[model samples]
Target: MTGTRLVIDGVTLTAGAYRLVEDVSLAARPGEVIGLVGPNGSGKSSLLRAVYRVLRPVTGRVSVDGTDAWSLPVRQLARTVAAVVQESGAEFDLSVREVVAMGRTPHKRLLDGDTPEDAALITSALAAVDATDLAHRPFDQLSGGERQRVLIARALAQQPSLLVLDEPTNHLDIRHQLEVLGALRRLPATVMVALHDLNLAAYYCDRLYVLRDGKVTAAGPPADVLTPQLLDEVYGVMGEVTIHPRTGAPQVTFLPAEPHPAAPTGAEHSSS
Candidate 1:
């Protein structure tokens, strides 16, 4: 199989003295789109960093296609995994095409230039993300959404078997968000994405792992996991989960909390 199998076994992540994720175990089959959905500071980004080798876990392991990811050489790991993190700081001034072409570096020898195949891949990647028109622009000058599309194009150009993206839809418009996620769904790579939009996750992901306070609160298909009680407990909100008639995916609608009673009038407070 061309797709990669991802197994995150009993993974725990920490930052210095602070623990970020605890005993989180998840798996993504070849070509599957798995989602990590959670509130802010729930350790979604931390776990993703472990998978992409940015942050090593204090305990447990991340494996890609049955090989321990931590044991792989840096270049080999890059060839096997591509990640699009939320932090998009451009250290150097480069054209969008130049940035996308960087994805070919892991496969090339020192001082090697782009082959025809590399060029084709770069072109296709831009098209896949709807960034073809911005290819000639300076990456630093693009808007947040534009830069996001370009970065995704760069990752697509890498053609890795496993793709890890931290909020790939961040800063994108509604149409582009759907388009970008739809493109990801068509790829052959095994994808793991962190998303705050539960409805989008429900529609796109094959399975979901919900995190809360750095612990996994639920894991299963969206329909099985996204109930009103789960939403209330995990998110502290009143929500309704229904199966979409056309898509058959769980649809979530959050209800407003009841208004608090008006503060006591000044005269009443004075009387007290």
Candidate 2:
């Protein structure tokens, strides 16, 4: 189960005439897990939108497996890339299996019915995320974490070569956050995830791309990229970076913002 190489080459994305992300380029080697980290509105999700073909880059290109992704038919692209976004558009009461079965759409003709193989893949995807018990539950009724797992199961069933997710750990408990990310890293597909947690990003990703104000500020292995100076600059917080004993990955512990030295009190500022 080899994965496709993902390349975002000098891509610039815009909303109308306003550029949201500019001249961004990053690569995920086949089967590598890459994390995008930054503050809110830093363009992590905007960059991901371009990669998943939701938002076309105003300049440059996105390529998967040596071909321009935008050039392929949507169906062909879907076969190669599957994304789990923050929200599920399925507003109706679809059961988990029914929702997961939607992933098979890329492989089926408009009128084709689910085959035994499709059933097997659906089952396997659910099991992969430990969501088998939720299979019969209404998608709308499940908690945010449960829904995240199911949506990921749907993406897995698509058998894509590259998997993209935006904040896949949102609303999940700490344990499930690790579980979900751990499963993603093990997948035989290039993964590009937009993450807000620098520590989690350090733990799971093979490389990191740090973005600020719609542009990439740094890119490298977690240990090299997650630095004190960069954190102070990008996140406006004082943080100490240390290597985790178990994973050997860089972990960031944020120190609280110190109060401004209280204005010279009383006599110091007094005319007396």
Candidate 3:
């Protein structure tokens, strides 16, 4: 009953005069991992902002469990939804554990100190993200991958019903990328993640939505959404799609486009 169902109804996202995503309707059922995949500048992040209540849609609303998310108080909204954004900065010189502990804020009263239960949750979250060693490290001192994991740990500590993340695998090594996505896959919360990696999306997401020119051009199970024609048309990249032998998920392998004749090769350019 704690898990949330998300409904985005005809959301038209915009920035100043630019229309990012228009009339877009999307849903994430409880315990579903829904992915948003698109090339850069394709409104993936923009759409997520609306779901997290950071960006108000031009003409529509986002609902969590059938209640308007934008109408809720900020603290109440935070209790139901947790977001791990791409640009989580460490301006304050806090420890990694301290940063993760901030996730418990919504659940505590104004003057409540950390309880034993809170401490236990924090410890468990750090361990889940493999950030136990960095718990005492200064937040600003960690590397990009380290910060990403720590931020994810912080979000996990929130224990929210809905989780929203943008590019959760950026800067991570292949192993950690798999680790992070795998963790997301195992969570009971409704997950909405934006990813550039098609193969990862295919592996982790229950459903995939392909965004292009600020619109969702295709949506379905990965096997149906990630076809060669769709990849070529939406991404302008030639790709081969096949079933992964182990997981039976769709696997995408990008092919090199035909080289432009006018573009010089390294040797030709050096001779010139």
Clashes of 2: 0
Please list all clashing residue pairs in model 2, or write none if there are none. Answer: none
Best by lDDT: 1
lDDT of 3 by residue, 18-90 (tens): 9999888889889999999999998999999999988999898899999999999998998999999998666
Candidate 2 lDDT by residue in tens digits, 13-120: 999888899999999999999999999998988888888888998898999988999899999998889998877566757999999999999999999999999999
lDDT-based ranking, best first?
Answer: 1, 3, 2
**Cα-lDDT of candidate 1:** 0.93
Model 2: CA > 4 A from native: 259-272
> In the order shown, what is each candidate's alpha-carbon RMSD?
5.0, 5.3, 3.6
Clash-forming residue pairs, model 3: none
**Reference-based TM-score of each model:** 0.93, 0.92, 0.93
- For model 1, where is the 10-residue window of minimal lDDT? 86-95
- Would you list the C-alpha lDDT of every candidate in the order shown? 0.93, 0.91, 0.91
Model 3 whole-model lDDT (C-alpha atoms): 0.91
